[model samples]
Target: MSTQQPAGGRFQTFSAFYPYYVHEHSNRTCRRIHVVGTALVIVIFITALVTRNGWWLLGMPLVGYGFAWVGHFFFEKNRPATFKYPLWSLMGDWRLFFETVSGRRRF
Candidate 1:
């Protein structure tokens, strides 16, 4: 698959980008790390809401991206789609996480 984006230079829709997103995360370890990061992000977000400690909210990206980046660098050996497609990449992350958890996709 082409890791460089489509012929037109950018992804016109999320639906088009999603398949590429899944392809990028082909590594089992990478997917598992991403899932763990997402789960931690959820826990951190809830803790921030419940305790009213807004500082904890700052950890969302750190925890999420930190783990994901490590997985990409060490396991996938590729750059993160997040750098080029932030919003869609985030959506892709959650979608993949849910799919894996639901047994629709492999972890």
Candidate 2:
């Protein structure tokens, strides 16, 4: 896969970036917050579509990143990987969300 690295890092693959992603979220609360934020983002997306309230779409990034940044700042005590690896970090979030929920990885 290819990416547009706005933060100018060397991660070439999602497979390669995932380990770092996992490490950044080592805190339990951070991971839990991420799960909740991801779920809420999904709900927000569906709500936007169902309700046809474009305003709800505005909350997607706010709710998603707000919770994520809170986890990073308070629990992880680190910067979010999203700042550097936007696409991969997003991929990581969904992958993590699914993995945690589907029993492939522990919550």
Query: How many clashing residue pairs appear in each of the predictions shown?
Result: 0, 0
Global lDDT scores for all candidate models: 0.93, 0.89
- Compute the lDDT of residue 82 as modeled in candidate 1: 98
Model 1 residue 40 lDDT?
A: 96
Error in Å for residue 32 of model 2: 0.2
Best candidate per TM-score, number? 1
Would you estimate the TM-scores of all the predictions? 0.92, 0.89
**Candidate 1: which pairs clash?**
none
Off by over 4 Å in 2: 1-9
Candidate number with greatest lDDT = 1
Query: What lDDT tens digits, residue by residue, belong to model 1 across residues 5-97?
Result: 797688988888998998899899999999999999999999999999999999999999999999999999999999999999999999998
